[model samples]
Each structure stands twice: as C-alpha cells, then as structure tokens.
Target: MSDTKILTLIEAVTAALDHEMGLDKEIVLMGEDVGKNGGVFRATDGLQQKYGDERVMDTPLAEAMIAGLSVGMAAQGMKPVPEIQFMGFVFPAFNQIATAAARMRNRTRGRLTMPITFRMPYGGGIHAPEHHSESTEALFAHIPGLRVLIPSNPTRAYGLLLASLRSPDPILFLEPKRVYRMVKHEVEMNGVALPLDKCFVDREGDDITLISWGAMMHETLLAADQLAKDGVSVEVIDVATVAPMDMETIFTSVRKTGRCVVVQEAPRAGGLGSEIAAEIAEHELMSLIAPIGRVAGYDTIMPYAKMEMQYMPSVERVVEEAQKVLKYV
Candidate 1:
C-alpha cells in the first residue's frame, strides 16, 4: 500500500475505479464520454487506455438507456458502474433506478441480483451553470432496495467506491462536485470495507453537535474551528452514508450535547435534514435541550453562478445555526 497524496476528489475516484478495474475482470465502466473523454469531470480519466474500450465504454447521452443497460449487464453476472455526469440529469433514469434496477432482487425472488453502482457528482458552490449543481441524494435514499453512500473526504470516497463495487445490491454513490477539485489527502489502496451506516465524530465537544454530510461537511468543520476560537467546543459528525443512517452515533452526540444542528446543500423542505430531525425528535426528544434546527438550501430552484453562495449553505449560516442552538439550552 503506497501512501500517495490524492490532490483532488476526482483523482481519488478515478484511482479507485482504476484499482477496481485492475483487480476484477468482471468490473466494467460505462457512461457518456467515459471512454475517451474520461467523463465530464474526468473521474474516469485514463481508464480507457488502461482497461481498453470494451471495459471502459462511452455510451449515448441517454441516462435511461445507460441505467437500463447497466442493469441488464449486472443481471448477466457482470459488475457495471455507470456514471451520470450531473445529479440534475439523473431524473431521466430515476424510474429505472427506483423500479427496474432497485427491485431486481425482490422481483426475482432472490433468483438474481443487480449489483450496479450509479455514480454522480452532486451539490453546488462550484459556480457551474444551471442544472450542473444539485444535491439529490435524498431522492435515492427514499427508494427501497437501494443503498446510498456519500463520502466527505478523498480517503472515504476511495474506500466507499471500492466497497460499493462489492455490494450485492444497487448503490447510489453521490460525490460532492464542489469539493471534487478542492481538497487533498493521502489514501491507502487496501480493500477495506468502511461501515456505510456509521457517522464519524470529527471533533469531540460538549457544547453542540454539528451534523452534516458531503460538501457541507467542509463548512461545518470550518465553523467548528471558528467556534473553537470563541471558546465554544463543537462536536462535528460526518454522515458518510445517508440511508440506513447511523442513528446510534447521531443520538449519542445529541444526547451528550443536548443541542443539534443539521446542515445540507439541498433544499430544506423534504431533504435529508428533515428525516434526520424527525428521527431525533421521535427517539431522543427528552434528551434535547433545544429544538432541532437545520441549515439548508432555499426552496426555490438553484440559481445561476453569481447567486450560488446564497442558494447553498455557507459557513456563516452554519455558525449562525450553531449559535441559535447553543442559546436554546
């Protein structure tokens, strides 16, 4: 295992895909521009040269066809990884994902399995044109028979992509687009299975529990650091996996701090934060010292590049919510 530094999240994802393709002959990559163009964000960069065009195929710009074909391929005992260039464009294939791809095992009465990974870059703040920035993980999480995994850092992204390739069920892997070229970290190539349902406590504190996932995690961490300067100890929890959430870790932190703030880049209404808040309210009501608060994107459609900062959650917003929750106790 070499300790190589991954300079960007896109590179980390590409490396993970490359590693998996090298180790397993059954694994094949399919998507628009994946073969020669290496995908829109280059997440599959150089894979075509390494694995050949048959293994790294570039398909038409039809998401439904891409998803349905991948399902068919997986049913035939091949592991297919399909990439949706952007999360907003994923709706074209939602029916296949929620029905055909996701329900294969149950529909077959356990006779067959569709083990496919749907990877898409999600979230805003990258200043891209409209339809290019979106956080739609909540949509997939609501669908049954599907596992949803969101990684906040390069190491987790690399590990989770490998594990998703090995999962027997279909997986919706959401990569934060805003951070795709922002951060850097060292990653190990060991095929370790990081628990998908557990949240990592990035910082331990007794004052408040700041819960966030994906790109928002970076803002939460920054807010925690800024809060620490003001003598406010903040507990940061990274919800790596959205579905089958690790309520154990979340409730534990809420019970300890008695204050919680959930943050996300998606719209506040009907988003993952709503479900998380509901869970806490239902199970840990008595332990709460304040009303569970959330910092999220506005309800309107995503704005243009100039107004993205206001459409998405910012560090200032996180700190404001933290301060509000801190006052409740």
Candidate 2:
C-alpha cells in the first residue's frame, strides 16, 4: 500500500492536526464550530470524535476568549491550537495575541514559551460576506515576536502545520480558504515538518521572478505557465513564511533574473508585496533589468460576492504586470 495519500490543502491540515494530537497529548484544539461542526470549512471534521471533547473542543463564538484561553494553556505547557474562523474576526483577539501570547517567552526570560498556533481562514474568492473575505495578513506580520505563516499547497500545508504545532512560539497560521480544496497532493503520513522561515522555489527560470503566497500562489503559477508559453522563463516562489521572510532566497532569484514581480490578494498599500519590493530595491537594485512589478488587490474594503473576483489579482493581471516589467529596457 502507498504511504502517501492524495489530499487537498485543508485535508492536509486535518491530517497534520490529527497526527500531532495523537503524538502529543498536550496539544488541544479550540474554536467556534470547530468540533461538532468540523469548522465552517470542515477542516476539523471527525477530530472531535477521535480526540474527544477535551482535545478537540468547540468554544463560544468569542475570538478574544479563544485566544486568551490558548495563551494561558500554552503558558501552562499545553500546545493549544485556536481557530479564529476568519481573519477579519481576529481583531477582537489582538490584545491576547499581540500583547500576551507573542511576548510571553521574551517577558518570562525564556522560562515560559507559548506553543500556540492561531489558525484562521483568510483571503477572498469564496464569495464570503463583508467581514469574511479580508486578507490583512500584514496586520499580524507587523507584530513583534509573532511568526506569520501561509501555505500554498497541500504538501506545504501538511508539513508547515506540523511544524507550527511543534513550535515553541506563537504563530499566525493563515489559511487561504480560497485554495483549501483548489488542489491536492500526494502526502505521506510521516511526521516530517518543513523548515520555517524559508521560501520554496516552485519553478526556476532566468527571465524574471514571481513571488507570492497563499491563494495568490495558484494564480502566480498559472501566470507563470502562461508567460512560459510566450517564451518568458519565469521563476515562481512561494513565500510560505511571510514574517521574518527569507529574503536571501528571493534576493538570489531576483539577482539571477534581474527582474521581479510580486502578486498578492491583499491591498496594494502597506502590503507584504510592498515589503518584498522594497527589500529587492534596497539590496538587489544593482542587478535590476527593470523596475519591480506588483499585482495586488485595491486599497478599499473587499467587496461582497459579485465583486470579489474583480477585487482579486487575476492571472491576467499578474501576466500584464510581468509583461510591463519585461518591456522596460
């Protein structure tokens, strides 16, 4: 029998959680509709039945309480994985996440470490309501002592979530719900965890480099395929761990290509794309063949269902931006 099974990104998440919870009894899950309801996206299906109420818990519809309780539990030596349901709903838990959970280890002089994984479904494209489709990952990425992580595919989702569960610090595990079931990968059940703070180069090319994460990675890859057909060799990178970004890999890619384009589903202003562009401009400007390009969402509130697609960065937009960058000089 094959050890590796085909699983979607969200299924990989469940597999990771189940594997870790079995190995470590100290790990517990808490969130709204996460237990019996299996999470709004069914990411936690059958976990409650397997681990029972204590390990896989369904909490009140209170984001603050969930985060606060996770912080306390983690401080007491328990690995608590709390779900915020949606990224837009996490603001209420900011006090606990930013002020407490993030600072626990440093404040306690390494005596108390918070092994907490705060999970949330983020990004647009699911036709969700007003507060359900925001992709404000930069908010938590700006917080000190917090590791921001986003997985682009099933394989990385499994490995990265396992790594997050085993971490000694607080992590914001942002799941791009848009791609939760967009694709699948054959993943082995071995408890192997991918390294944190590294960029995964999905494709290698010399003409230009494309950097993206989460759901945007899907579009980026698609755009790369399209660009390739037009004779443009595009290097595609998945910025899985956004915070404490692995700029070295990106710099190396940009240095080789001498041109770069960043794609993001979040707003253009104050976005992580801006940070990547700025970093490249600062360190790799001498290697440039053209100005850095960015394809991202607008700086306005994410519109509801019908207009959600319009607000997102499409494959065409990414290609257009890359072409514009390629056209320069």
Candidate 3:
C-alpha cells in the first residue's frame, strides 16, 4: 500500500501509467507528443524521463499509423497504451480500430488478443477548437469488441486505466478532458486495478437514479446536489463502462427509485442515453413512475468559445429535467 495524497486528475493518470510501466516491462506508451513533451496535456509528464524513450515513445502525427502500430504490437504480445490526442482526431484511426483492432480476436477465433489501450482526451468544456473537443464515445461503443471506459475522477481514472491495460481485448479509455484538473482528491499510488463493465454508485438516494459518464458525470453530480437540497433523494451512478454496461446495476437502481434521468455531453440521437432509455423501457418499464428524461447536447456541432457552454447540457438543465421526472405521478 502507498501513502495517499491529494492530486489532480492528470497527476493521477501520470502516476498510474508510471506505476504500471514500472511493473510491466511489456507495457509501452506511445502517441504524437507523448515522449519528451509528456503528452499534449502532460498526463504522461515525467514518464519519459523514468521509462525512457523506448517505453514512453513519441510518434509521427499519423493517427492511423499510431493505432495500426499498436495493433501490431499488441498482436506480438506487447501491451501498448497509445494516446490519440483528441477524440475528433480519432477519425483517421477508425479503420484500424473498427476494422482491425476490434475484429482481430474474433477473426482469429480467440487464438490471439490485442491488449491495447487507446487513450484520448475527450469532451468539450475548455472551449477548444473543433477537432480538439468531441464526445463520440457512443460511436466507439457501438463497435463490437472495443470496450469503452470513461472515468469521472482521479481515482477511477487511475484504476480503470490499469484495468484496461490488463484486459486481453482492446479498450477505448476516454479521459474526460473537461474535468482533468477541475478538482483534486487523495489518491494512493497502489497498482490495484478496478473492475471493468460496472456502474459505480456515486451518491445514494431513493427519489431517482441519475446516470451519466465522462465529463457529464461532473454536471450530473452537481445537479444531484441541487436536487438533494429540494428534498429529492437522488442516487447518482457513474456508468464508467460505457458499453457492455453493467445494466444490472442500473436496472436495480431504477427499480428502487421508479424514476430515471440520464445525462450525456454527446448529442441525443443514438447516444448511450437512448440505449439506456430503451433498456429501462424494456426491463424496468413497469417500475418507472414517469417517462425517463434525457439531458444531452443538441444535434448541432459543438460551437467555439463561450458558445460551447451553451452547447453542453448545463447544471440547470439537469436539475430542471430531474424535477420534471419527479413530478410525474
């Protein structure tokens, strides 16, 4: 066990990678500016100095090549954690991810596995340019073999990333860029890995189940507090594993609360929220007292600067929606 100290989300990420790389020689970190620069966000800061260039590698600005190289390394028994800079930039690597990395296991009938962790900073709250900010977790989650995990805080980010590296299949580790340094918490440097495909109960309440992941989890929790002050009991669940979701956890909560409000930074159509809503409708329909409410981004492209705030689902929006759901008899 290691002594716990308060650290930012990015610091926790760096510590996890450093700890993992120290323990596993086969584990390698590669990306556009990951080497001497310590990644674009410095999440890999000080790693290159400790692990050296071979383990903490810097690659050309080729997104496809980065992922393709990772696939080959993974197939060859190397654990490659490749960062894609931004979710929007992940487009060039779609073929490698959707076609190669995702299908390798099934294509070979489980003989070989791609133990690769594709890390990317995602979501739009920093007013970054068009390609710097995108919340397309749903697009990647739709892929069959790729497991998607988003962490709301430093501790989970550390544990989940460690787990992703240990898994035999490919993983899309989308770090909520918006909350990277929003707050700090005491995180131990222990190398323990958290379980994947699970929903974590962030706050326990009985009035309603508030479900969300990634950067939206911050907003969801913020709204949960407001609802709490109003005498509404809200149970907040962070759907950390976006796909292969631990629906048992979600269904159980909805069954207890009889009402649900799902929030997402992504657009409404075809987002994970819709999938959750469908499940609630199918399995938990009888338990629901009100029609489920969804708080999500609009169908339009995320705008620039100040307008970005308008594009995302605000705290008020989540509160209002939760209140509406509570009103239904």
Candidate 4:
C-alpha cells in the first residue's frame, strides 16, 4: 500500500494543523468552539486532546477580540492561528485585521512581524443561513498588507495551510466549505508547502482560458470538461492567491489562447473578475481575439437556501459564456 491517505479538504485542514502544531511550540490555535468543539466544521478535530487547552484554546464569541489577540500574540513572537467561525462574522474584526495584523510588519519597519494565519470558511452552497454563506474575499484582498489565499482542493488545502503557518506575515486563509467533503484526494503527510502568490494551471489548452478559485473552481472545471467534449479546448487556471495575483501566468495563457472567461462566485460588479479583465485589457489587449468574458454571481445579495442555486453561476452559465466568447467576432 502507498504511504498516503485519502482525505477531504476539511480533513486536510485538520491534518495540517495537527502536524504543524506538533512541530512548532510557538504555534497556538484559538477561536470560538475550536477547542473542545473542534470548530463548526470540525477542521480542528481532536487537536485540543492532542495539544491540550493552552495550545488549542477556545476563545470568546467575539470576532474583534479574536483578531486583536492574534495580532498581539503574533507580535510577541508567537505564531497565532485564529479562526472567524464564518466569513460573514469577520467584518466586526476587519478593523483589527486591516489596521493591525496586516500592517504590523510594515508599521514597525520589520522589527515586529505578525506571523498570523486567519482561517474562515467562505462562499455559498450547503444551504447555509445569511451570514454563513458570504464570499467577500475581495474585501480582504483589497487591503494593502494582507495576503488572501483560497484553496480549491485537498492537496492545495494541506499545502497552503502549511505555507500560511510558516509565513512571517498575516494571511487570510479562506476555505471553501461547500466542497469540504465533496471530493477526496490521496495526500502524503509530507511537511512540504506550496509556493504562495501563484496560480495553478489545472488544465492546459490552446483555445479559451477558464479562470476561477474557491468553490467556483468546481463548476469551472466541470465546464472545462463539458467544453472539451464539444471539441473546445479550455485552459483552466486556479487563482489560488487572489491578492498579489500571479498575473504573468494568466497573461501568458491569455496570449496563447487569445480568448478568456473568468468565473467568480462573488457579485459581478467591483469583484476580482473585473480586476482581472481590466488587467488583461491593459497588458494584453492586442493579443485578444475576443473580448474577455465573466460568469459570476448576481449583483443582488445572496439569497436564502432555496434560491442559492439560482444566484450562483452554474456550469451551464459558464459554458454559455465561454461559447459566446469563442463565437465573438
């Protein structure tokens, strides 16, 4: 038998935390229900039993306090990994994240660093309630001193979580909860960390480029397969790190394919898709054979459970948009 085990994204998270916590004595994990409860998704399951309460602490149900404590703990040379139960619950702590944790390194002229990893589950699906289904990564990505990372699969989840823990700066690690157990991968328990601020080319093609990250990657890859069956070659790119994006990879792919469609689960206006489209237009406009396309969530608020599917950009919408881009004269 191989020295690898099949693990879901959430299980990958737990494994990464367990492995890293065992290695680094300075690394402490704290958040509401993270100790005895092991997080709402059980991403930290059994860690408290392994490391005890002092290391795997359960904080009060206050987001701001959690963020503040992470900033302070990290400043004192401890690697603090804090969790905000859900993405929507983070706004109350945005000030702490944007002002303190993110800017601490630059603010202190590199004398002090906030080696903190803030974890939260984002995106819509699973029929979650109002605040539980927000995909506002753009909010954190826009901050000047923060790094925003979203992993699309179990391997990336394991690698990225390890990378974030080792980073000397603040990182917002967004987990796609919808696909927490949607698929599994055989992952070796190696301590290797994937490079940060890079794009992963999931599929290489010569026709159109399909770009997306987080849970939207699931639909984007499905659309790529569907398009391939129709004899349309699609190059798929996962923008793992939304902030400080590896635009050169995208530019190279678009220059080769000459057509591109960006899929984002966020709202259509003022989202990262618009940013990518604008950047491509600015840098690689003459190389384009057609106007860049985008398939994203509606501009209105993400609705309740029943209408969630209607609001999300489905595989059909992505294929339709890709076809339109390909057929454009």
Candidate 5:
C-alpha cells in the first residue's frame, strides 16, 4: 500500500525482529555475533543496543549449545530466536533440534512446548566459501513437527518471520543468502502475517507453471520474463513453505497451465522438487498435459566461490526447462 523503494532483504529481516521483540516481552534473540556484530549478514543489527544484552545475549560458537539453550528457554515460557549462522553449521545441533525442540510438545502431552525459531542463511549464489552456501531446507523439512518457511522477497521475508515467531511449533526459517541484498521491494508492517502452509502465485499465465521458492524465485521470475518476450506465457508459483505446501495453488496452476517445471537450489535427488513432482503426478496426472520437469542443483556438495554458480539453479537453466515443458503441448 506504499510506494516501493530499494530495501535489502536483510533489512526486512532485521525490521521484523525488532518489531517482534518490541511487541512481545517474552521474545529474545541469541546467537554468536548477534549482540555486537549483529550477525554475519547483519540481520540482527542494532538489536542488542535496542533490547539490551540480556535479551540479545551472544552465545558460544557451539550450535548444539545454542539449540539446547533455545529449547530450554522456550520450554520455560519464552520465545527464543536462535541464529545458526549458516545452514552448513547447523548439523552440529541437528540432534537437539530433531529430538528435543521438535518433539517437546508431543513428549510432554501439551504440557511443554518449544516455541523456538531457528534462523539460518541458506542456498548458494553469494560465491562464498564451501560450507557457507548450502540449500538444507529439504533436510529440515523432512523432519516432522517442524515448520519450514523460506521467503523469496522482502515482504514475505518480513511477514513470514513475524508469523514464525508467533508459531506454537519450532520453525526452521531459511533465508536465501544470494538474494539477501539483490532485489528490493517496499514492505509495510500493516499487512497480516501469512500462514505457514500457504503458497503465493507471483505471476499468472496459461502456457506453463514454474514452481519454485527461496532464492530460485528470482531466477524463476527472470525465466518467466524471458519467455514472455519470446511470445510464451508463464506462471510463477512460490512455495514459500516447503513442508506444508499449498496444494490448492499448485493443483490449480497445473490444471490451468497443464505443464509444470519445479525449480530449486537443492540437489535433484530426493529434493523438495521430487516431492512436489510426485504429488503432482499422483493427484493431477489427468489434469497435466505434460510430464512434470525439475531444474535443480546437481547431486554434489557445493563448490568453492568460483564454481558456486555451477552447483545451483540458474536463470538460463530454468528457461530451458520451461521451454521443454511448454513444447510438450
């Protein structure tokens, strides 16, 4: 509802954190460098100054300690937002997240709830060191009792963060490090928080539907624009929440376009795209006019800064897949 301006995705994330901390006294932020350094990406910039060190305390460089402390804090009636720095480093705390935080409510029979939010910058594109850029959303999504929300744009990033903080269950909030400062869009806090299970249709067309999320949304949009210039219409859908996908939107788009091409930065084998492709095949087989295609990263560890682009999905790759699916009709 306001004029659009250039704003970094990290700014959106910081704004959401500040807003939530101010709105809820029980909400607190903790992680390495989150206090003084304001996080590696500066996503928590100035929070320690605003909320004081007690609430925004900086912890040891131990992922497991961060996760365990957050779980205990959440169980004690406080909402703790823990930053994992990078997705690659999150493996150290996988057991705490999977066994303790995620299963707390069920284990306690509703007597205890772990309302902790795990924030991690993920996906390749920034040309960072090897472990710094990884798409681990699918790994977290595979775990039950945890909500996974990955936002592509500024508005959704802000809204989804607010929504995740207020959620009753543990949330895995993955931000695309590549687009953290690339695209800009005006964001208003007046908008309602988006549900965790919903998907968004960025563009509508009759030719083919491009399903994607996280950083890949930007490339998907570029592909759609290129196809538009070539006299081909394309629809773009953002699966903002990978765990509980918006099946209604996905099914409707496939039914209308009759073709789908899922794009993701994760590896092709057993990736989120594979699950989506399977769901579409099982439910919308009759509605689809062509076999669903997937454009994803190769099945290998992300490479160094120079070869990072080769490990993730690119605009040209998405465009080629769209063309292949479009030709099926």
Candidate 6:
C-alpha cells in the first residue's frame, strides 16, 4: 500500500506549512496560540515543537499588531506567514494589509518584495461564533496590490499554499472553515506548487457553467450532479484565486455552455460573483443565452448558529438558480 494517508483539508494545511518551513529557514510562523497551542483549529499543531520559538513564534491577540509586525519583518528580509484566527477578526489588520503589505513592492519601486502570506479561516455553516464566521474575501479582491487565493480541497490547500509562500507579493490565503475537515483526499508531499490566478474545472459539461470557490464548491458540484441527471449538463469551475482572476478560463467555459450560474457564500452585493457576472456580460455577452444567475448569501451579518443554514447558499438553491438560467435560454 502507498504511504499516503487520507488527509483532511486542515491536515493538508499543517503538512504544507511544515514542508515549507523545513526548506525555507527565512519563513517565520507567527500568530495567536499558533506556537504552543497550535492555533484555534490546531492547524499549526506540532510546528512550534519542530521549528522551535525562533521560527514558529506566537504573538499577542492584536490583529493590527500581527499584520504590522509581519509586514515589517517581510520588509526586513523575512518571509512571514501570519495567521489571523478567523476572517471576522481580520478587520483590525486591514489597514496594514491594504496599506503596508500590499503596497510594499510598488511603494519601494520594485526594490523589495513582500513575501508575506496572511492566513485566515473564512465562510459559514460550521455553527461557530459570530466573529469566527465571515466570508469577506471580496474586500481583499478589490484591492489592487494584494492577491486573494482560496482553496476548496486538501490538494489545492497544499499546492496553492506552497505557491503563495513562493510568491514575490502578499497573498491572502482563506480556508473554508466549514469544510476544514469535511472531506479527505490523498495529497502527495512532493513540494510541487500549483499556479496562482488559475481556475480548476472540477466537472466538464456543455449546457451551463457553474462558477464557485471554497466550501461552496461542494454544493456547486452537488448541484451539477443533479442537473446532469436531468440533462442540464452543468460545467463546474472553481475560482481558486479570487483576485487577479483567471477570467480567460471562465470565458472559454461560458462560451461553450452558453449559460452561467455563480455561487458565493458571501453576500450578493459587491461579492466576487458580481465581479464575475460583470466580466461575463462584457466579454461573453454575445455567447450567453441568458442573463447570469447568482446564488449567494444574504447581505445581513452572519447570524448566530442555526440561522447559518439559511444564510449560506445550499445545493438546492444553486440548482434552482441554475434551472432558472437554463429555462431563460
């Protein structure tokens, strides 16, 4: 039997970080409880023991300080992978991220590179606390200098993280908290990195295009399966990198399908789906048979526990919107 064990997406995150830290002595891991406690989700488990306090050091609970410190360290010639416990808590760090880290390379006139990777778990449906669940990736996507990359599975979690670490610029790495341990897949520890700003076609079809990312990819795939049985022929595309989007891949798929349905766990207003919808309308307008459909979360704040189900876009919801788009055609 192969030595590869079935690993969840969270496990893949730990393994990938461990692999990178081993190779790059300059890569420093810092965050709240990330050292001794191994982070809130234990994604940094055992890394502190292996790399010691010098490399895998823990930080205070201040998000702004964490972001500023990481950017400062990166400016002084260090690759810092700083973790913000949850996406909701990332607000305090936004100023540093948008102003310092993202603007570093351009600000320095290409004299320096901010090889900083900001890690945070995002999205809802895990029944977590208010500050722990939020899908605000679009806020970073709209920023010019920063890059936002989201992983939908264990393999991409491993490969894309490696790529983000190797990047010359800053990267916002958002993990879908709901699916952190939802599915397991065999991912090799070969240290190979996947390309950023690229889309992965999870399923191929000829009738309609279904675009999504993060945990929502699971529901999107499920909807595609049901639509497939009904002869809808849904093509599923995972927007791996939210920023610097690989629109070419989507346009090609949309051209073939003639219809598109975008699903996002975040609110519909100013969400990444809206951006994709705009691009489709501009470039593939002639090819599209119907107006693009968006299945997304509500605009209100992500409510407490049980209400999460209603806030998140479900498989049924995606299917309903997809059906509507096809019917319009």
RMSD of 2: 1.0
1-329 in candidate 6: lDDT tens per residue?
32565789999999989999999999999999999999999899999999999898888789999999998899888999999999999999999999998998998898877999999999888888777778999999999999999999999999999999999889999999888999999998888899998999999999999999999999999999999889878789999998999999999999998999999999999999999999999988999999999999998988888788888899999999999999974
RMSD of 6: 1.2
RMSD of 1: 1.2
309, model 3: CA deviation in Å? 0.5
The digit string of per-residue lDDT tens for model 5 on 197-218 reads: 9999999999999999999999
lDDT of 1: 0.89
Worst 10 residues of 6 by lDDT: 1-10
lDDT assessment of candidate 2: 0.94
- Deviating ranges (above 4 Å) for candidate 5: 1-6
| Residue pairs clashing, model 2 | none
Candidate 6 TM-score, C-alpha based? 0.98
- Once fitted onto the true fold, the runs of candidate 6 whose alpha carbons sit more than 4 angstroms away are 1-3
lDDT of candidate 1 over 25-98, digit per residue (tens): 88989998988889989999999998899999999889999999998999999999999889889988998999
- Provide the lowest-lDDT 10-residue window in model 4: 1-10
Give the per-residue lDDT of model 3 (tens digit) for 221-317.
9999999898989999999998778999999999999999999999999999999999999999999999999999999887876688888999999
lDDT of each residue in 293-319, candidate 4, tens digit only: 999999989999989999999999999
For residue 115, give model 3's deviation from the true position in Å.
Answer: 0.2
**TM-score of the candidate numbered 1?**
0.97
Candidate 3 clashing pairs, residues 3+ apart or interchain: none
Clashes of each: 1, 0, 0, 0, 0, 0
- Candidate 1 collision pairs: 123-134
Global lDDT of model 6: 0.93
> What clash pairs does model 6 have?
none
Q: Which ten residues in a row have the lowest lDDT in candidate 5?
A: 1-10
